[model samples]
Target chain A: MLPTPKKVTVVAGSGEGDHKLTAFDNALLAAGIGNLNLIKVSSILPPECELVERLDIPPGSLTPTAYGSLVSDVKGDRIAAAVAVGFSDRDYGTIMEYSGHCSREEAERAVRAMVEEAFRRRGMALRDVRVAATEMVVGDRPGAVVAAAVLWY
Target chain B: MLPTPKKVTVVAGSGEGDHKLTAFDNALLAAGIGNLNLIKVSSILPPECELVERLDIPPGSLTPTAYGSLVSDVKGDRIAAAVAVGFSDRDYGTIMEYSGHCSREEAERAVRAMVEEAFRRRGMALRDVRVAATEMVVGDRPGAVVAAAVLWY
Candidate 1:
């Protein structure tokens, strides 16, 4: 039996040009969470609800206050929230990437922060997260939505 | 609101694609198939399962065969074997054509035919399906694990 288990959540992000969506899915699954097991996480996000802003945004133009406001707009409708995710892959880091519009330095920092938070919340450690994947894709022509997902064990 | 209620189902020739997966999810919601849902369908064809030489291939290679196989697999796993599949569109057609492989006509015919046998035992009519969108994608790769979800109201 394996010592570690991976978890993943599938977020349908915009992929107008680049294979960003699939890439993201791949990243999460590679991180060991591509199981996509519905029984593990069915409808994590509510159906037909406006998404709120990130509770924490990477160092970027996305203002925390603005992000908080966006959250308020979506907080009312957020229905499908899940505490954990499922995976098909034995590892889940294949699909992770840096956050969007942020420098690599900032992206790495963001990941570190997230890892810490995940550990604090779940009592897990960075070493335990064997596979890891992250991304930060920006829209070339505009009118794109910035969304992301996290997978860990 | 519109007068006619909608019935939709998105069929993924391969289960793990981004657009097709997204469209399939949207179709299920459009069909108003209660809250029934599924995630990452496990391929019934085992790792050692070999492709047999068949003089008679279904209209769509990804036809109800794999999907039907998937249904039976799900049923075998304790879900209901009695399922209904309603076809709305073939979003992957363009990709198939662009790959310089299957012509648009051949691609469309394939998905349409597949939708038929998928629901054969359900006592349902393929024509009764409400197709919302069907587009062909060109210049693509091959070998996709197909998947479909049926919602019964």
Candidate 2:
């Protein structure tokens, strides 16, 4: 079995590039997690995982992450991404992500609601919710927004 | 850095369900990997990784995987998914995935081409290629197909 991550961090950023994938890469660079190979995981925070202020993973390391991202090529298009982590008092936490052509506040609200619903479905009491969100308007080039919960050792 | 996975397995399956997410879930179940938490990784097989006959993951374990999946709700729609792993003689291998409204043969070809292109770009010798593919025609309920290369300890 893979080891559960010991630390997690929330981050959000926006960037622009010539193409969608490059725009996403720039967004991740702006978010401070561009160097690692991200393994996208579904929204489950391991039991006893600790929240950290920042991530310090080595370059090219495999990092498990839960993320929401949106890229738009149309000029003036509004795009937003958000991620939320809901803590439980006595068990594992839940993570949720949202992305759309909307405002940052709307994206954040959607992710928070998703986290709440997830916790409710598990019959777990929500202790706290940590959220990160970003929004941007596309220009001539493609623009991307990314919000993520990075889980690491 | 997170530890590199030592073993990998390829599998494919198709299933039907009431909703898209559940259809995807059912597809995973049919693939014999429904209970594990999948962490989606990009196209890279760790150096010296061994190919295994089957996965033996415990329920709820975090499993790193590279996969392609497609869900269709339109009746008579043909959906397909495929994953390919291209091994190199002296370095890490590359994985590629594709999903679309197509036949299983087309999907497999597409994924194999992607793997070859990835290896060429890296200037790596293509030692071997392993592929898994599946296709399904949607009925009344939503249908999903999944192909995955699961990486484990």
Candidate 3:
């Protein structure tokens, strides 16, 4: 552990660009994590971590993040992404990420249930779960939707 | 959860398709998890679970899985995805996922380090870490690569 992440921020964004990869980068920029080196990691909310609405990360930092994203070049197609984190007062937390051809609410609901079910599997009680999401409808240009859980020290 | 996930399997695959969405499905099919409903969940390898190379899953079942995937439309562009799970003798395990325009081995090494870093953050000693990955270069069609950690009851 370089430094145990003491805080985590959930972010979601949608963007349009000339190409698929550029659309993804634009989405990341909209989510406020575009500049950092995103080290895609799995879902775990460390103990006693604080949840924030926004994150201010250093550029070029190795950020451990869990994310779901979709990019589409087809017109009129919907792309959605969602992330949820379930936490208990006395236990570590669970995280979930989902993305596909769906609405933001549907994606959010699915991931939330996943987090709750994960806690249930662990035989732990969850106080609450928080969700973040993004959606986009592809048009003439490539579009992307992204949902992410960013871990920070 | 309905029943606690007692077993986990890691899988990786790559595929090509006419479109980005189809490329993703083809990748999943190559990974042997295409028919099932992938319920995306966070990275907690439950205590007392067994790790296996291949999974015997019933079709249409809701499987809790954590994955990283990338799709590219550029010809000759390389894409890679990797997943790593860190386990200890007396503790729950942690999982990490990574995907990008890189080689498979590089992706695997980055994810493995992320898993070890996660365990270290928790002040836990890791007995070992297991890794799985896939990579491919796009040709005329869109290409996708995925790596996953699937949890089963």
Candidate 4:
């Protein structure tokens, strides 16, 4: 079993590169997370963890995260990504993420409804919800955008 | 202010496109979330929220979410992304995300430590945690990977 993360943060960034791959790396770098290895995982916040604002991880460190991103080579094409977690006064919570071809406002509104529906399905009363997101249009060069909920030891 | 999300879900997907942007869209579709708009948000799972296995969002509906993604055109290069949330029985939680060039295991380990340290700083004891992630080696065509925490009304 993997070690459980104690605290978490939210982060996002965007960049352009000579190639789609490079653009992604540049975006990670812009988000201050370019140099490390990333391992993907599912959702489930541990009990007792705290939330923070920044990811100060060292370069080359293996990092785990949950996030959404977009990379496009089509000029003038709009891309967006967003993440949100809903929490009540109780100890349980739910998480959601989305990415697509649209404006940031459109994306945010869509995800918000999803958050509310998630709570309704669980029959839980929500107290507050928090979010982070990014949006961009493809230019002459390949571009990328990202948003995430980051966790750490 | 938007309505607070009561529940959230995490998701991730990967795909290859003729171009980098299409690759991201295809990946979102593969993850079963391509049809909706995405709103980015930060971490913080509401207390008492429940975790579900799949997203049954309607097509063309707006959705709120938090996520990380990448698209690469570098052939034979490995890429990965991860997201995790930690929660205690208490009323708080933490989230983390990572992306880079490496194996999935390496990234997962790194993020686990990040979670631990995050809690250590907060002086909180962790009871449990959950995660989502993805990894792939790029081929001749462009490829993408993503992980996310999604929320709904």
Q: Once superposed on the true structure, which residue ranges of model 3 sit more than 4 Å away at CA?
A: B1-153
TM-score computed on alpha carbons, candidate 4: 0.50
lDDT tens digits, residues B81-118, model 4?
77676666765554565667877776566556555655
TM-score leader = 2
Candidate 2, residues A1-153, lDDT tens digits: the string is 578787889999999998899999999999999898988886577777899997889999978898989999999999999999888898778777889999999999888876776566456799999999999999999999999999888
**Model 4 ranges with Cα > 4 A deviation:** B1-153
Candidate 2 clashes between residue pairs 3 or more apart in a chain or in different chains:
none
Docking class of 1: incorrect
User: Cα miss at B103, model 2 (Å)?
Assistant: 5.2
Q: Write the per-residue lDDT of candidate 1 for residues A28-86, one digit (tens) a residue.
A: 22323222211111112222222232222111011111000001112122111112121
lDDT accuracy of residue A145 in candidate 2: 99
lDDT of 3: 0.83
DockQ (model 2, Cα): 0.22
* Order of models, best DockQ first: 2, 3, 1, 4
Put down candidate 3 lDDT per residue, B71-93, tens digits, no spaces. Answer: 99999999999999888889799
Q: For every candidate, what is the interface RMSD in angstroms?
A: 19.6, 4.0, 13.5, 15.5
lDDT of 3 at A89: 82
The candidate, 2 or 3, that scores higher on DockQ is: 2
**Model 3 agreement with the true structure over A1-153: per-residue lDDT tens digits:** 024567789999999999999999999999888898886655567777788877887799877787899999999999999998777888567667889999999999878866765566457799988888999899999999999988787
